[model samples]
Target: MKKTSILNKLRSSGLRPTKQRVEIAKLLFNRDKTFHFTVESLGKHLAKKTTTKFALATIYNTVHAFKKAGHLSEVHLRGKNNTTYFDTNISNHHHFYDSETSELIDINDNEIKFDKIPKAPNGKTIKNLEVIINLKN
Candidate 1:
C-alpha cells in the first residue's frame, strides 16, 4: 500500500499516522490476503525486515489500536494457554484451525450452514458468528 493511502486509513480511523504506525500498517495491510499473527510473532517478523526494531510492547499497542479501529478481529481458540490470533479479514467468515501445525485457514461464509440460531439475551443482538473447526493430521 502507498504511504498516502495508509496515512489516509490512519486518519480515517482517527489515528495519528506516526512513523511506527505506518511501518506496522505496512506489515499488516500490504498483503494480498488476510492472515493471523500474535504480537510476539509479529515483532519477530518485523525485526527480520529492517535494522530498526520496535519494542514488543509497541507491537501489542499497535495491534490493539488496529483492532479498536476495526481493521482486525480477535480469534480465540479453546485452550488453557489462551493464545490470541488477529485476523486481517474483517468480513464475515469462519476458520479451520490445524492445532498440530498452528495454522488457520479461512472458511468462506457460504460453505458452512447453521440449522438454527438461538435467541440472544433480552437486550442484546447477535453481532457475529465465528466457527473454529479444529483439525488433526
Candidate 2:
C-alpha cells in the first residue's frame, strides 16, 4: 500500500501514523491477501524483513489497536493451548485450523451450516458467531 493510503487508514482509525506504524502497515496491507498471524510471529517476521527493529510490545500494541479499529479480526484457537490469532481480512468468514502445521486457512461464510443456534442469555444478544474448525490432517 502507498504511504498516503496507509496514512489515511491510520488517521481514519484514529491512530497517528508514526514511522514504525507506517512500516508495519506497509508490510501488512501491501500483500495481495491478508493472512492470519500472532504478535510473536509478526515480531519475528519483522525482525527478518526490515532493518528498523520494533519492540515486541510495540507490535502487540499496534496489532491490538488495529483490531480495535476494525482493521483486523481476532480468532481464538480452541485446544490444549488456546492462542489468539489475527486475520487481516475482516470480512465475514470461517477458518480451517491445521493444528499440526499451525496454519489457518479461510473458509467462506456459506461453506458452514448451522442446524440451530442457541438463544443468548437475557439482556444480551450474540454479536457475532464464528467457527474455527480444527483439523488433524
Which of the numbered candidates is closest to the native, going by highest TM-score? Answer: 1
Residue-level lDDT tens digits of model 2 in 53-98 = 7988888888888888888888866534566788998998989888
Tell me the TM-score of each prediction against the true structure.
0.88, 0.87
Name the runs in model 2 displaced over 4 angstroms.
79-82
Show the lowest summed lDDT stretch of 10 residues, model 2: 75-84
TM-score computed on alpha carbons, candidate 1 = 0.88
Error of 1 at 96 (Å): 0.5
lDDT of 1 by residue, 1-137 (tens): 78787886677667787777788888888888887887777888788875666877778888888888888888866533457888898889999998777778889899999999999989999988789898888
lDDT against the true structure, per candidate, is 0.81, 0.82
Colliding pairs, model 1: none
What lDDT would candidate 1 get against the real structure? Answer: 0.81
